[model samples]
Target: MAKKLSSAQLQELAIEKKIKRRNFISFSAFFIGAGAAFGGWKWLYNSPQETAGITAGTRQPLRRALNKTELFFRRIFSNDHVVKTYPKERAAKVVRVNSDIGMSTDNFNAANWQLSVVKKNGHVLKIGIEEIRALPKTEIVYDFKCVEGWDQIQHWAGLRFVDFMAHYGLQEQAEMEYVGMETPDGAYYVGLDMESALHPQTLLAYEMNDQPIAEVHGAPLRLIIPVKYGIKNLKRIGTINFSNQRPRDYWAEQGYDYYSGL
Candidate 1:
């Protein structure tokens, strides 16, 4: 048989148990509420269009809540805007060259390929592949990070982008905020900021993995900017233009970030 507790002791034990139960209930409620709020917010904010009679416009408060939620997530998930490097041992043997914008042209003639560097309202500089090859060649084995969260480390050989720009005497152009490149057929193109175009690892590549660039890999001439996503690293150069206004990018026009860089 158990001894009965005194009234005071019994009251104290009851209070303690009540407090513990209240704490557990409070914690459980907090998490449940949080999850529901997040789900409600997302459903409202991301639904740009209406379903039946329901519309994002009908849930203005929820949408605003979700805007705050996105801001919080952006702060938490925004990785330290730094480029990652790996040793040669860790580098991938076959780095895929994905973009084929300027490559699939009837007149992409690699034998007669020439890079035209255009300045605003001035004479353009036409440079042959040999001229670019004559400049100091640099090899960078770096990770090619895509905006879609994939990366590969590949060896690249080319003239430093800044040096190449300097060689053409277009570096001093203060009005050039954007650089635009297009395939000969103009099917695909990209725009980049001057800062990204001049990153240390950026190159105007003509060779990959110690061999001449393959036809599928922007043979003869290509832009290699490791600091940016693959979309900005245009392949098969046709025309290079410097502009003050923001240039049209093939992807950014389709709701991607214009400055898709590290």
Candidate 2:
């Protein structure tokens, strides 16, 4: 004897089958997507790595990706590109200071602070703060952007980096590929490409918000560069070196973007 199902029973059985089919397809798709992501990560992990002198390797693929990103931004970047400026009234009332790396009393003495510049030809020049102030002054009221995603309007006054280079007769060094700036103790350092280093708004700033720059905010001498995030504006510059090869960057060595353009 065979049993026959009613229309109601047949419809219920069809719905159940469709539900199971849909679930299977959904699970299959989820697993496939997960596997693809894991496979990509694994491939990158197994890629070849090259050794740099002090650092062993950061993996070639990741380094290449960072370099490509830098190149992409640089294609559209230029000194002539003007950064937005604000009225001095909008500047932050209280100076905000961060990263006191080389600003400690043990490392810095404003009395003995003389800029040390090393030329490509191995010549060294010691520059005093007074000499820097004597150069034509430029002031800018602009937003100070930080990598941590906070920004404040800042008022800064100092000499244009280009004029400083010209005043020092550093024409040869200015033409070099890179510039390196370090704190007195060499605790913190940043490398700059020539184009950005010579940006018209880049300044060796000594004043902020209509007053002398405070000790907490790199007093007497610091770089006020509008185009870069605060990190590129090396505080309490101790030494400047010129080279054809890319100079070392503190943040870049730790996997931050070397170019770090806006």
Candidate 3:
């Protein structure tokens, strides 16, 4: 009752067997590769060494990588990517004063308060608030973001840093990559990239909510940079320095990124 197949039929059956075997082999390889990758990720994720990297007074490798990635993206984006602005009615009437690190001294003499500028040419200039007010004023009601994940739209008015530089004849140093600012007592400081510093909205704000800034909120002078987190907005700015080298930062030393951009 059995029937024998021709040589052509036998060849086809052989080819079908080989094809199924090849497909099975490929799928097995893929699953095995995926399993290995998952296992490696789990091991790294739960590793004590990885956790220690962040807590052991060293820059965590992962955190550093993340910071670099953020910086890279910011650099690639246009400097003109402006932060959102709101109408004056939407701005908060009472903006919170977040930190008082450098404001402890009771001897804040507003009458004699002078902002010091360190030029790239090694000349030091002490500028008064009257001189700053002489420049054209820029006002904006913009979202002020803090590192603590809170935001408020506040109105501020001040001279643009670019205009200040131009007025002081320091525009020649615009090519310098970093701007450094510090409190008079050196208790707090911040560093900024030139791109953010030169942004049109960046300001050395002296007025808030259409009035002179209160002493509790960085009276006399403060920096209002919407492009960066509120932490980068140095209060009561005392000294400004222009440098090609990256300057020291308060939060970066405490494990935050120096470029704390929005």
What TM-score does structure 2 among the candidates reach?
Answer: 0.82
What shift in Å separates residue 93 of candidate 3 from its native position after superposition? Answer: 1.1
Task: For model 3, name the residue pairs that clash.
Answer: none
Query: Tens digits of per-residue lDDT for model 1 on 140-218?
Result: 7888888878878887799988887777776566346778888767777887766667667778999988888888988
- Deviation of model 3 at 51, angstroms: 16
Query: What 10-residue stretch in candidate 1 is worst by lDDT?
Result: 49-58
lDDT for predicted candidate 3 compared with the true structure: 0.84
Model 1 TM-score (2 dp): 0.73
> Which scores higher on TM-score, 2 or 3?
2
What TM-score, over all chains together, does every model reach?
0.73, 0.82, 0.78
lDDT of each: 0.74, 0.85, 0.84
lDDT of model number 2: 0.85
User: How well is each residue in 138-173 modelled by candidate 3, as lDDT tens digits?
Assistant: 999998999998988899999999889888888767
Ranking by lDDT: 2, 3, 1
